[model samples]
Target: MDASSAGEGFTVALASGETVTTRQILLATGMVDELPETVGVRERWGTGVHHCPYCHGWELRDGHIGILAPGGEPFAELRVTLLRGWSSNLTLLTDGSASLDRPARQRLEALGARIDERRLRAYEDGPDGGYRVCFEDGEELPVAGLFVAPSQHQRSGLAETLGCGLDTAEPNPAPFVVIDSTSGETTVSGVYAAGDLTGPAQSVILAAAGGARAAYFMNHALAAADAQAALTAAGLPAGSDGD
Candidate 1:
């Protein structure tokens, strides 16, 4: 699908070879999660593998948990620290991707978490339950669950094509479309955004809330614009209330 600015509004060219116009656009395009190259990670996503601590931590509480800290992820240390609260039997699998600083090591040691720097081979269902962590050096570890921080990106390039600004600041490993915090309005006046496309937190509840808010604002904008158009057509001066 192709989207572009058309006069005061926007136009969308659908894949079915139909062109559609709109007065305003709400972009709930969402995001794409890019997981690691491990064999079983993709197949086991959601069912066995997860990314958020708050979302999946409670279920695996007090059980053996392994966190895959891929190389060059700036938030690796932070993820390890956060996961420690949910399970005392925590292991940091670096997969030979990163070196821990002295302070970072001390922090993990303080949390009584074990560090496993072996390269990962695959993930599999254990004989009993949970996941089997396979290493390249011919070893395996069993964990109740596994956590991974996958890189995220916009699912559709229409946001960028529509000239919406992106938030490229730190702490956000990936860039998200910039939107007004209150209204979810994008840099483009008639364009708005919500959900994973606007922020890093991937919670469904937050996405729903953002969409609701953007819709509220969009409704007001649309109503006012329609009223103004009607008044102008009647040869009357439009007031603040569009009367």
Candidate 2:
């Protein structure tokens, strides 16, 4: 289906070519993981490559783990720190770019996590579907699981079609859709966004929370507007402007 649009009201084009117009639009398209172009990374993504350390850390605990992120891009140190709880052998691979700040580097090293700043040559899958991270220096790290924070974008192009503004956090320079802190309204009037597409607190729980918050405010607005319209239709004063 085509995305919603802005004008007198929100218009969303359906797959059958019909259009549904409404007073408000909620852009809950979510976010998509922009995986690195590492050869094995794409092939072994769901199996061994993961972005959230908490998601697959426990399963690969006590084994080698690698934190892979794009080179030259600023990433969160907290990510590496969190994985330390899962495994004693953790390597933060910069993948060839000089992104880690000295303090962040110090913190990770202090946590007993090795910092591997070598350029990633490629990711080779093991017979068991695990990975072997090959670096330019010909060093190979046998890892059971790899944690990476790849760039992310709105899952669908619908948000852009709606003409909404976006915001981005560190490590990723791309902007995502912007929304109100309380009501979750978008930069565009009558349009709103929530979930990962709006901010970085990602998870099923957080996504549901954002959805409920946006729904509450949207319902309130619709109720008030519809009530006023009904009063006017019935030839009533509609409570007058100043009331």
Candidate 3:
């Protein structure tokens, strides 16, 4: 559906080119990950390479887990910190740009996590479904799986096209659609956002719950509006509908 920007409320143009207007809208467009342009990464996305540690950590626990560090600053620190709990043999490849302050480094070292400030060259499949992360200096670290925090972008630009405000996803520079933390309402009135398009806590279960809440709030608002209109027609004040 084509989101319209020139009206009082939300409007969508369907495939048949017919415009449908509505009082409220819920945008669950989701997001897309901007992964590293390396061989074997895209091909083995869900298998060897993954995004969320909490989601895939238990499955790959006790294996030689590698954290492909690429994002700048404390993001890498946070990522490596979280991943260390999932595996004892944890290695954080700094990708040549991740700089952990003295205290952060000490904390990582204390946790038995190794910090390798090597530039990543490429990825290769190792024996028995393992992976070898090749560095520019010709060193390789073998691991069962890799976890990375990739930059995320909106899958569809409809939110921006409809004049929705966006906010930066912290620890990284990616901008997500601006939404109320409680109700998921966008800056533009009558338009709401949910799921990964709103924040970093992206998962099927969370998205589903977010969608349900957005729908609930939208429905409540619609019912209130209807009640108000009916009260106005009956020559009563808006809040008098409670009677």
Against the true structure, whose lDDT is highest? 1
Candidate 2 vs candidate 3: the lDDT winner is 3
Please identify model 1 stretches exceeding 4 Å from their true place: 234-237, 241-243
Estimate the TM-score for candidate 2: 0.80
Best by TM-score: 1
TM-scores of the candidates are 0.93, 0.80, 0.86
Residue-by-residue lDDT tens digits, candidate 2, 1-243: 676555668777888999888888887887778888876888888688887765677788888888886663455466677788888888877777556678867777898878777888898876575678998889888889888777776788877787888666553445678888998998888888888888766778888898999999888777777778899899986664321
What's model 3's TM-score?
Answer: 0.86
Q: What does candidate 1's lDDT look like per residue over 15-72, in tens digits? A: 9999999989999999899998888999999868989998898988998988887652
Rank candidates by lDDT, best first: 1, 3, 2
How many clashes does each candidate structure show, in the order listed? Answer: 0, 3, 0
Residue 122 Cα positional deviation in candidate 1, in Å, after optimal superposition: 1.1
- Between prediction 2 and prediction 3, which has the larger TM-score? 3
lDDT of 3 by residue, 4-99 (tens): 755657678887989988777889988899887766688878889998987899988889888776634456666767777778898877778656
Q: How does residue 20 of candidate 3 score in lDDT?
A: 88
